[model samples]
Target: MGGSKKLIVCGGLFLTLILSIGATAPKGIRLGKASYRKVTISWQAPDAMTQVAHYKIYRDGTELGSTASLNYTDETVQPGTKYTYKILAVIVGGGNSEFSSELPVRTLKSASFENNQLVEKVVDSFHDTPKSDLNAVSLISAIKAGFEALLGSNISFSVIDENIVTSVVVEELNWINTVTPELTETERLAVQSEIDAMMDSSFAGNSFDHMYINQKLTQLGDEHWGAGNRTAAELFYEFSLNYLSNHESTVSCSLARLAYFAKSHLTQDSSCADISESLSKAKACSERFFDFFPNSAPTSTYAKSALSQPAAWYFSYFPKMLEYSNYDALFFSTAYETAKRLVAFDPADKNAVQRLKRVAAWELVTLQLRFVDEKGNARTGSVKICNVSAENGKRDLFHGDAYVDEREFTLSNGTATVPVYAGHDYSISLNVDVANGNKLKFELPLFKYEKNKLVSYDYLTNSFTETPSSQSRTDFVISSTAYPYNLRADRGIDVFDLSWDWVAPPSFTTAGFKVFRGNMEVATVNKQTVRLPLNNSANEYRYKVVAVDANGNLSSTSQILTVYPGDQSQYSDFFEWMNRYFGDSDIYAGDDPDNDGVDNYHEFLNGTDPTKVPGPTPYAGPRGFYELTLEWDAVSNVEGATYQISRNGTVVGTSSTTKFTDVNLVPGVSYIYKVKQLTPAAAATDWGLPNTFTTQKAHNYEHADKVQ
Candidate 1:
């Protein structure tokens, strides 16, 4: 009986759910190609709809001009916005069906065949260079090719996208533009002109050939669909290998790539391909570059180049051997023998021997860095890295300018090389005061770096992985030019009303802003703007902002700005109040001791007591129209008190009630008002506040609504 009752309850609940849903969601909803700033969505009518009056379309939850058909043409969207669309079936009887399935789309930038070939030319040039002289341009160009090859038909600025490629490009451009000490106005303008021209024509005209893009998309689809047969490490390693390999690696390390692929493939199905011969070929090839040590004086730059540049490039694929199931042990035994040979060739080759051991152990060591922003967009600047003392409790790794001069390094192209010490802990720090001036430092674990590897921190997922961990820096500028503004004090207590529009920090690790008046930090504010208390006699103020990253890493930026003190807002009235009530040096306009949102300076401007909370209501309704009528939310809690209203500092009227009328004020002019509550004892009614309203010009009688 209980089981029957439960089944009945379940059946009733399912029926209720079906009734509430009302209609089935549309099937076969599809998004068309969205490459040129337009998208189309189509779907079949839901099977549940009956007597459908018309179909309604919605974009981004808002109607983008509804349609009565089953499809939508959205032409108003840009490349930057990803739009989602859905359809609903509205009936003649005023009821509506459940919304159809949603389809989201975003336009992708395309490049022409010639542009693609040109990109290949750049990559070829980069790949042909010797590793020592092969700057970021070579590596980045190669990586760019890899991106075009491996990136699926997806639009995102993720770690897996082309952010690393563009970051290098931006770094190179910045290096060209920013003069080490400073850039003059003329030089800056010249660089800016060049950049504008390049943006207008150089990159904008490029688009991928449709067939080629389709081929890549198809390839990506195949790989993704078949990825379940492999391990996550193997899949990720394959992606890394495909993205990092250029023509040179393709030609020379063909067996290496194939053997690695086969090794992983054989784990699932051994009957597919014979990889034993390919694996042997790869081991023999790896031995060719295993003997030379770049750190030692092996006069043969040829041999060093073979090992560190082209050869090291090839051997870097050695990690995939470990990622394989069977080939790892097989490859490690051979690599260990190669290490023994290096020690035999040079009895003093301790480093080479250790590297061999690392090769066998699969240890990670920092080889290169690609600095980027919090969004995984590459950054172009110098970063300070330090080797923290294993003993010192201070961990003073990156508080302020420690080893800035000694360990300072800028990315080449968008990369920098650091010596790999197998077991040493390191820290990278920078000042990132873009939002609120701050400094941060990130401590790195030695365990994270694999031998001859790169940082691959994914900004999209906010995750870190060794070997291709996309490195990033906080987006911030500490100089004067960060969204500058004019500084004008209220003259009563030398408190300047600061309204500076500054750049927001790109990272989430910032603590607050530290305001410096010349040499000393005058105040700290976490927000963009704060009332800065200036010296009574000083005529100008200079401020800088710094940003702090999550790992306490700090990024310092240029671009400074300065604002001079202008005429006081209330030069006459405020000074008089301050001087008459207390010494001019004691009470400051910015000081709000009572924790009211209204500052003491604004209080003096309105002749209200600053010591009390809710002191003489601060700024009431500053809203409403031409020949404007203004109103306020009345102050209660006071007993039998009347109110005094003032317009433009002149006593206009007094009412026993909380209402007033100011007639015929000139249009297009500004007016200020204040209200004070009056007690029956005739004491200072000390309630109410100041507000401002400006009248608009009279409208022509063209439109009946009369709204501007």
Candidate 2:
């Protein structure tokens, strides 16, 4: 009588087939077939309604079957059995009409259920030795149709696919989950049509297999963001046209030959000989274009007439690898001119259309190749890139080399804005002038079509990093840069103090040096100092620097610097030395390589060994506006010693002198404080008495001075 807008839930899974809508009665209830072991119930939807979502069938009084279209067949009936059927029309606006008058039906005494018995037989015979070739899918569909015709909806059945049963339910779940969200209404309709075709008995056997492959091909296109209803034939047509777009008769003819060969694998192999021979002869004509399309020849020749009918040969084609690499102009005024003449004579010529699309997609297939420094700022350069071989499922094209480096393009402002076809593979490399002879450098592999159109080659590493998911994310330094000056381990920032600094010789001419971590150039530091972020505290890293001149020449590297917890101060002499190279080091100074509470500078100034911590108290100076400073009391005059001060157990500042100013405090809140001194040996002095202080409280809300 009534229905609510509910999620289509059937049995245990979600069903989307029926859109049960408003109440409106269907007319002309009738029994189409009544026989033993089978019964068919039918009804007529009113002609007034423009859309009928489905018909919900009810048996006796229980709702059971739901069919998207008219008619239903019930095969579960026993011989000589009688049954009653009623139908409710489900409409698009989430409404269900009243049930139609019941149709009384009976099973005949002699009706045999051959499909049902065949399913049972297949299930019983399935095994691993020969993986059951029996058509269980069709048999299941027939059985489902029979049951759904009467009482079952959301009908799905599976048998042992092999010795190991394939879980069809899981496959269905994945299918629904992967596609439902992205499926447009049109796409859904197309998918449904494919599904309907699959269950259609007319498309049985190999024809059905071909349909399934084409459906998946459409899905592949969808996955890659291709739009519209595209058929396999259309894809092949576009592919072939891309070849003929060269406007060369031999090029077109060569591709035509390939297509003819390819079609044999797609359809009946024996029937494709004429097409294959014709393409061969066409290639021969292209080679002899001067003789065949002579300037003296009449325009109304038999050859010209046949050339107008291009559709017959223009479905798909590919030039041989040698032809692709030749790079010479072809099929122009000679053979290609003849093809165009045919096209002008016949616009609907399938050959002409296919050829033009190939030309069109040529523009579509190519994407920009960008080159930039690790920072991704565009730079100019003559970069060479090799493309991985794309056999297009036919490796015979690339005989000797599996991959070729034929693709080479220069950068305009660090980007080659040229388009390349899909499935092209890229390998980046460039020669550098070094102490030795020029070495062939390489970059990471960038697969075309698999990656976005704008691919990047980093300047520092000469490699490709990750394919950035967004344009903004590519701004970060994923690669490294070279830096100059002897890198000395220095104090890090903040309390956790996981950061480490690389201090180099300061110079006004220092444009910036590249800072490298392993093979990666992490950053180009304009200043003489750089700090590692605390996030990398867990990972070990090798540090080296090469200063860059104003002219951008990198000087000789100073030496490799190593850091591990508990070894920050072991290399202070090497770090402190100018124009010096330090090879071996267990630690460095003025840094918290040990990750303990205090820094090396504080330990040095507090008359404590830079290697030990909790040694001396730090003295505090007068606090200033918006700044709090703490200094290590001059208990020891260790060279390059510094002080660390904290407010209520939180580190606030570091100073080289015995006195330090503390700034930026709340006006009213009282805070307890502590201080520590550090030295060149990466030592720290801790355990200073907690001194409590209260700042002047603010009374006026409007004054900006009170906020700081």
Candidate 3:
């Protein structure tokens, strides 16, 4: 009975295996012509299988290797090889289904005359077909031939309906709507005809009303307003407007153009009231245009231009009336806002920054002067001022002692005083540094002085002078004439040598001096001669000279002297080599040191030459340890040598050696190593190309325990 049970159990297992194979059978298969030299076979397995171990691929009854994915490529098959392939779906339970239906496949071959000749013949025959005999057959043949040609040449082609083609062409010509006045009558007529035809075509909806309205508007916008049929153009534009009143986009564009023309033509009119009304209408139209075409570039540009005009018109009235106070506030506000917007729109707009500065200067006329002492302490002084009533001008106030109170003053402690004039130009000077001989002399308008009272002459002028007061007032004064020395080295020169001429003011005698190197004052120079010590390693250096006067008056250091190193004669060669061989500057500086298993410098110091060619250095004993000895030909003019060893492009060790034996390396592994040589001048030679070697696998008896 026990023997019988064993037999039944074994039979049951066999039956289960067969059932698993049947359940895991592939349900579908597919094939496609993807490329040459390969064939793809894809299959879908039955859902009853939980895990598919692999699909066994077969061609012409020959078994190929199995893969887990449903898709497989028979890469080993040669091009033009014809075969029938099927898949055997295998389950993880050691069972597989029978072969799938055989699918015929042939690998692609190189182009031959047979394929091209047939396609050519077909196309030529189709083209030769009589027009009366033209049919689907000829059309299909021609299309197929074209497709074949395109595919073989690796080019792309697409088929589109007539509607898309017409739309593309019409949209491309929209820019012609804005023609310049310079266009001749013939050119204008031709353009108008073209626009009419495009609008009348199916592409633009064949709307005759739209075409008529557009033509009328275009006539009004063409040529110089007064020169070319102004009456007729106005009539057309009016008629166009009546029809396009409800058409927001068209109506807005027409109104804006009309307003622009009116403004330009009525510039010399006795009254600008009508022009202002036209501008208001234009602004309203622009608002409507924006609503209709919010993202349109042309519409947005028109809106911005329209908005800018009203402000300009208002400001123009003020200057004409000479009502400076009334218009001053308006001008300042408008200028400020416009400048801010311009800056926000185009951060790099220098014109906008300059405009802002000008507006700020206009506002400076309202500032009051305040005098301060050496410690920024306030001082009591009476200033008499006067103003000059010119357009954008102010009167200058003078003191009883002939000091100009209209000017701004700067104290030695860094405080400033600027006079204010409402609408006139005033010359204001700042009394800088009173206690010490240092003084800052600057002249700014009452308005501009507020913004920059400490500087002399608004950053644009020269020859600013200040007189010292005998009242024993403590103020910081700056000399008007301060010229700093500038030094720059010639290119390709590694070291910089510099000298300059210094002239001291007659009122001030030279007391002590300091020479500045970088940010630190390196030495005191009583005499003019000074030698600057520099490390040739750096590319550039800057120096300055500080001079002190006898009365404790300190002047800012001389202008910075810049020095550049190296006579770049070798730059061309260096750049050429860098481009041709290095390809990248960063690549040469990568951390890989040695061509061997060591750092380049370390290898050199260990008596190993880094520039040596790499080869196999095998160990003689157990434990798979080997020492590699690297050596190379000595480079001429090299004072001493440093070496690095690299394994597989990674630094593993460095030594000063003709050869280094690497003992810790594993056997049976391939390694690529290279070396670099360092010269006495600290320049490094390019690493030699790598050499590859594979260590022999250790014998089991050599290190039997380690191997196991």
Best by TM-score: 3
Residue-wise C-alpha lDDT for candidate 1, range 1-708, written one tens digit per residue: 332222111111111111111012224566533433455666776566477778787888987766667766666665335677777888869889888666655443322221333333333333223223534444444444443443333223232223433443445435433533343333433653665466446333222222223223223323433544222222233232222122223222332433344344333223212333444444454333332222334543333333333223223444344332324454445445655555555556566655555454432333666655545544454556665534333222222232221276666555566543344345655423233533322323222345534445532233455433343222222232232222223333475554433344444455555555655666666665567655535554665544434465434432233556566664667767766656655567666765667786687865666665542443433334434444554555656766677787788777666556566677667888777766564334454556777776556677834564
Per-residue alpha-carbon lDDT of model 3 for 1-708, expressed as tens digits?
Answer: 332222112111111111111011123665532223455666777576457788898888989878888778666665335687888888788888777777665443222222433332333333222323443333433443444453443212122122322332233223222331344323433654675577445323323333343543344334324345443334334444533343444555676666555555544343545544554454454444445445544324444443444434433333322223333454446545654554454456565455444434344343434454324445432333334333232211110122222332333224333334333345344433323233333333442232323322222122232334331122322233543233233232122334444556667687766776677766676666555544333433667776778776766566566564334564455344434534543322112334556543344334444444333332222223243334445544445566666777687776554455565667677667776654443545556556666665656687664753
For model 3, where is the 10-residue window of minimal lDDT?
Answer: 14-23
Model 1, residue 648: distance off in Å is: 7.2
TM-score to native of every candidate shown: 0.25, 0.22, 0.27
What count of clashes does model 3 give?
99
Per-residue alpha-carbon lDDT of candidate 2 for residues 1-708, written as tens digits (9 for 90 to 100) = 011001001111111110101012123776544433445555677577457888898887777779986777665666445577888888788787877766655442221222323322222222111212223343344334443433335444321111111233334434544543544333434654675466453432112222332233223323222322223223322222221122234223433433433343433233334434544455443323334234423343334434533323332332321134332123212234445565665566575655544432212243555544445665444446565445344243232345444556565665554444334444544432222222223344554333342344333333434565432122112222323323456544211221222332344244567777666786677665666542244364666767676878666554455554454465454345411322234333445543555555554444333434454554445554444544445646677876666777778777677776666666666667666666665545554555666555556667757454
- Model 2, residue 43: distance off in Å is 64
**Per-residue error at 91 for model 1, in Å?**
99
In model 1, which runs have C-alpha deviations exceeding 4 angstroms? 1-297, 302-315, 324-327, 336-657, 661-664, 668-674, 678-708
Whichever of 1 and 2 has more lDDT, that candidate is 1
Q: What's model 3's overall lDDT?
A: 0.44
